[model samples]
Target chain A: MGEFELIRRYFASAACAAGAEGVALGIGDDCALLAPAPGEQLAVSTDTLVAGVHFPEVCDPFLLGQRALAVSASDLAAMGATPLAFTLALTLPTADAAWLEGFARGLNRMAHNCGLALVGGDTTRGPLSMTVTVFGRVPAGQALTRAGAQVGDLLCVGGVVGEAGGALELVLGRQQVAAEIAEPLLARYWSPQPQLAFGQALRGKATAALDVSDGLLADCGHISRASGVALVIESERLPASAALETLLGAERALQQKLGAGDDYVLAFTLPPRHLAELQAQWPQMAVVGRAEAGEGVRVLDARGQDITPRQGGYLHFME
Target chain B: MGEFELIRRYFASAACAAGAEGVALGIGDDCALLAPAPGEQLAVSTDTLVAGVHFPEVCDPFLLGQRALAVSASDLAAMGATPLAFTLALTLPTADAAWLEGFARGLNRMAHNCGLALVGGDTTRGPLSMTVTVFGRVPAGQALTRAGAQVGDLLCVGGVVGEAGGALELVLGRQQVAAEIAEPLLARYWSPQPQLAFGQALRGKATAALDVSDGLLADCGHISRASGVALVIESERLPASAALETLLGAERALQQKLGAGDDYVLAFTLPPRHLAELQAQWPQMAVVGRAEAGEGVRVLDARGQDITPRQGGYLHFME
Candidate 1:
């Protein structure tokens, strides 16, 4: 099939959310049209995934497609915005019908779950890569920012962390873990679920907010640096999954959970007095630590002992 | 330098016209924020450039940076929207400070010229490539599209064509052209000037419009197929440069000129009766052809003889 037909048949048919309030016109157009609500502003972000770099060359195409969109959505989640639409720029060596079919299916599944519509993009012949740019809307001044945290704010995180890092270790055969333990961890690494709803809930409450993409310690450090405060993460309180305990043991797993990346969970700060209200809305949150009047991050054990690890977090270029 | 510093020290300084007009915030944040005019709508387009595909591997870094952003902005021009802001995703094999400096300089020059600001994007270690997504604003229902052409509308082109293609030929050493002719052509190919003002002027006037990125015949074929009409080109009327004429004699130049790509010129359909008003506004426009009652494209020389070329235009995958 030609370029236009390939786009319409595989891409334009992706499952989108029911309503079209923000999206004025969707796929199959020269450009996408969007109109934010009267009182809302637009938030935009973009990311690119390259073959053999961002993911393994032999990895599942379907999951890669889903993860590609999810990573960009994670940025919107970091901003506390409601998703509206997205555009994709896809480059491939050839027009492989089967690959396109599987990729589109994965893209549609994730897009529908996030309440986003596929708008406009381009397909070209080149080395394999995909670039997704996502849009979201939020009330003016309501979007969370990493620079808003105060020294006295409580630091918190949503859901489990470090499962994606453990999954990568298993995938690379660096560890001798069982498939049953490895399978779910691998899935988490491949398809991270961005905490969109949780992020929106922090709009007016959280002093600072960002998605934990690089790792707990590193990402939280971003908030501290931007907000000009010190972050004290309680190492013993770091959330860990059962799979992580079974594979890496509780001690090393604790470190992995703290330093591993690709966990698209919202990490935010709130006033100590509003901790009850935060828990009322989100029961899954863990009070990881607190912000202090200083610079940089410090990790403390349950006994109040400083237990900072040697490395900060994963660096893609160095790895 | 690390990713964050590389961006702040180089890429974040580009000026965006929209940022001053209530973009609210941009770059250096989790997500870029923009407040649209009360009634205006947003138009978005994305394009990716891979190393050895969209550009040569050994070209000047500054030019590559300028061209990557320019190509994406060309999409905004096609939709008859005014450029607001843009995001950049840069993937590099390693951290090359000199390359980043040159690229950012080139990108900033173009962004300043177009009044667009760099917002938020991702930077990762991977195969070398750059993806730029541009945002523009247009009044509701005033955006130009490919489906608005009527059978009797006149086909017009904004400026010179085939210079870029001829320049590429010279660059690849497929032909030995003089420096005087080669430099101008190469400049046109590497540093295209997007017709932003012209496109904005045509918003309520032109029937349909698109940038000539994929050759005249193929790009016009998009309008013909979308508008459900045949597009006939008067070959003798095609605007050709003296460099193109000198490189390939009149006959061959006409063929290459009709089927060459990367010109970044605007092609649109206008009502014949509006010629006087259009000329008064956009005197640079040159009438070259007209839409017909049938499907497909037909080319005729000065003598009314068929001048249809063998292979009509460039195909991305075939390259």
Candidate 2:
């Protein structure tokens, strides 16, 4: 079969095997038609993960596929949009059937997890890379953004941070730990969960929000700049998994928590009262910091001493 | 500057320079939020053009930008969707300032031309490629689809065909022609206009439709397979421009008309009554054939003898 036929049969049609909601038409048309309910908005995001650059060239295809969809879908989570569908633009050096099947399986799994139906996409021959454009539906005026934070808002994370960064150090051989400590960390790096439900629950509660793909400090900086407020993160309150602490000791683990990337946890700003109310339902949302009437990010030790690092995130080109 | 910063400056923010409506939040957010008006469904399509496969590696960046967006937008046109917004995923091998400027200009100009606002996108470093995902609004259940064509419907093309195919010959140094012949053909190839207005006009009229990127004969085959009907085209009814004829003899031009790709015209099915009515409004829609009871596509000579060709469309991987 031709590559187009291969993609149509295995990838495109398989994406809809379990059926999809909000799609008027899917898979077999020039364009997929999506019917979001009246008074709802569509949340869209695109992310490209290049082989060798974004991940190791020899990584498992299944994990790669899962990571790719997860990365893009996290944007919808950040926006408090419920996943509707996604389009995959895949560039491959060759149509390796085994790799394609593994990738398809991985994509299928992730799509099911995130409720993203494969709507439409294009496949081309080139270096191996995948670009996923995700679409979600959010009620009008209810989507979260980084520009809505205000002074006196509690800066909270949906869950623990920096496990992915810790995983990266192990995977790249920059550091090592026992298999027990490494397993969960690697899982966090390879298949980070997008906090879709928490984001939806935040709807009108969180003043501003974003998924923490960059380190916690760096992503909070985005909230700071966009919302025109300062974020003061309390060092003692930084959420770290026991695995991270056991793997790297407290100080180094704290560095990973502060400066490393790809956590996919949500860092959000909300009034203290709202945080208290939401924390009652979602106990994992820890208040690590607060938004203030200033600019940029400031870190304070347990005693409120200045402890901000020079660099807060990864920049691919600059690196 | 880092890759993200550079993209924020040149590509991402530039997407919103003209201000896109229906987009509640655009660049600099995790996801772009778009609000389609009530009763409208979102039409989404994605197309990727890879260097050395879809286009030459050293082509003009500006024209490449225009061509890339035009190609994907054609799908929306085929679906009779009104242009809404688009996201770009650009992967490049380097960060040349001039090339980026030229590309952004081309993208800006084409987005304006097609009325597609750039809402969000990503920029990555890799082997050069571009993926554009476009969104448009079509009233629920009113979209034109390949499965909607019925037997006895008149098959019409939005405009002339084969110009881009002829131009590709000169572009790849496979052929040469006079400046006059090359000018129009090259323009057609470099910046083919998506028939957005014509498509919107055909809404509630055309039974089925698709953009003719893979040559008219090939795209018609798609409608045939999809609609469970046959498409019969008369050789004499094929539309070829004077430039196409001048570039190649009438016989060669006719072959290109049937076999070559990238015309970006619309081939649609319209009932005789609707055909007549739409013709009164859009004279450029030339009736070249009709749908009949069968499967696949058939071509006939002016005298009505079967002249079915061996190949239908250009498949990138197969080729």
Candidate 3:
């Protein structure tokens, strides 16, 4: 089949493409039309995953599909935008029917979970890569950003970190463990659920916010640099999942929690006044750090001594 | 340099990222924020250009950059949407500073001409490819689409076609010509302008519209299928530039005019009543044919004989 036929068979007939709320027009057009509410602003982000670079060159297409959309959608969560639509630009070496079907199934499942409609996309022949561009809407002047953190704000995370990082060992066959430890970590790696609802709830509450893709210390540095304040992380308070601890032990888990990336958890700064209220609503949200009147990000040990790591986060083009 | 530093040096500090009208936030965030006018709907489209497939494996980075954005922005023109912002997902094999500098210069030039803000993007290490997702805002209910063509509506194209097709010979080193002929043809290949203003002018007048990217015959088939009508093209009336005819003789030029793609010119169906007024304003716009009660696209000769070629257009994965 041709490119158009492949897209029609796998994607256009999917459930998410069946006229979602904000999409005025979907596939089969020069452009997809989206009508956001009168006073809302659109949040847009684009992410590309290349074969052998972002994921294993030979891996499950279904999981890759889910991970691709989730990775892109997390940017919208960071902005506290309501999911609206997305466009996928897929480049593949060949048109394999089974692979496309599996990929589409996973993509549709994630689209349903995220409330994102598949509006439009382009499929071409080339080395395998997928670029997903997600769109979401947020109320005017209410979207969360990384530039609003104030001194004395408590830095928090939406959930446990480093599970995906720990899972990398299992993915590369470097570690073997019980199903209990492996399954959860694999799930975190393959199908990270963007903290969409929690991010939306952060509107008007969290001082500054972003999804943690580049490790805690490094991503916190983004908040610090953007807001012109220092972030002090209490390393002892970092949350580690039971599975991660079981697989990698305490010290390594701590290292992974601080240094490894791809967690897809929301890290934000909230005022102390609103902490109790937000914590009451989101019990899993953990306070791990605090913002101060300084510059840069610092990690503090139990003894209140500086313990920041030399390396920050994953740098894409670094050798 | 790291990926972030490379982007900062080459892209984030570029002129296009300096806060355009519709963009609330440009780079340095998880997602960029865009706010369209209150009564406008956002028009979005994504296009991917892969190295060795879309363009030559080795070519001028500046020209490649210009072509990539222009190819994507054409979708906005086809929707009759005013250019607003775009996010580029660029994957490169290495962080070559010279190539990146040239690419960024060309990208900025087109972004300025197209009135598109550089909202956000991701740069990574991989085989070179670029997926550009462009956003534009069209007045609500006025965006032209391919589903609105009516029987008896005149089929029109915004400008001449086939120059880019003729230029392919020069690009691939298959033909040699004078500088005058080569310059214009190469320019057409590298920098075909999107008919943004012309498409906007067609908003209320044109019944259906799209940019011709997949050859005239093939793209018209899309309109035919979507509008549930047959498009009859008078092959004798198909416009061919003098440069194209000079490069490749009249018969070959005619074939290119009918079969070549990548023109980026707006093709639309308009009521006959609106033609004179629209033509008065857009003198380059030409009447090529009319819509009829049937299916698929048909090309006819001056003698009223069916002369449609068996091969309609280029297919991505046909081999």
Q: State TM-scores per candidate.
A: 0.96, 0.96, 0.98
lDDT (tens digit, per residue) of candidate 2 on B169-266 = 98888987789888899999989999999999989989999999788888898899889999998878987589998878898888888877787889
Residue-wise C-alpha lDDT for candidate 1, range A1-319, written one tens digit per residue: 5555667778765623224878876665567788898889999988888888777777777888899999889889889999989988898888887998889988888888887788877788777888999999999989888899998898999878889888878766688777789888988887888888888888888999988877888888889988999999998787768998898888878877778777788888889987898788889898889999998899998899998887767655543
Interface RMSD of each: 2.3, 1.6, 1.2
Compare the candidates by DockQ and give the number of the best one.
Answer: 3
| Candidate 3: tens digits of C-alpha lDDT, residues A1-319 | 6666778789854434335777888887899999898889999999999999889899999999899999999999999999998988899999998999889988988988998888889999999999999999999889899999999999999999999999999998899999988999999999999999999999999989999888887899889999999999998898858999999998888888987788799999999988888889999899998999999988888899998988877878777
The Cα local distance difference test for each model comes to 0.83, 0.86, 0.89
Lowest summed-lDDT stretch of 10 residues in model 3 chain A?
Answer: A12-21
Q: Answer with 1 or 2, whichever has the higher lDDT.
A: 2
- Show where candidate 2 strays beyond 4 Å: A12-14, A17-19, B2-4, B11-14, B17-19
Candidate 1: clashing pairs of residues: B16-B116, B16-B117, B17-B115
TM-score of chain A of each: 0.94, 0.96, 0.97
Q: Can you write out model 2's per-residue Cα lDDT over A222-308, one digit (the tens) per residue?
A: 899989999999989987589999988898888888877787888899988786679989998899988889899998999999999
Error of 1 at B275 (Å): 2.1
lDDT of 1 by residue, B1-319 (tens): 4456667777866844234675877776678888888788898888888888777778889998889989888878888988888888888888887998899999999998887788777788777888888989988889888888998999999888778888888766689867888889899988999989888988888899988877898888889987898988898788858988998888767766788888888999998987788777777678989998988878888888877766667765543
Q: Indicate the residue-level lDDT of A38 in model 3.
A: 89
In model 2 chain A, where is the ten-residue run with the lowest total lDDT? A12-21
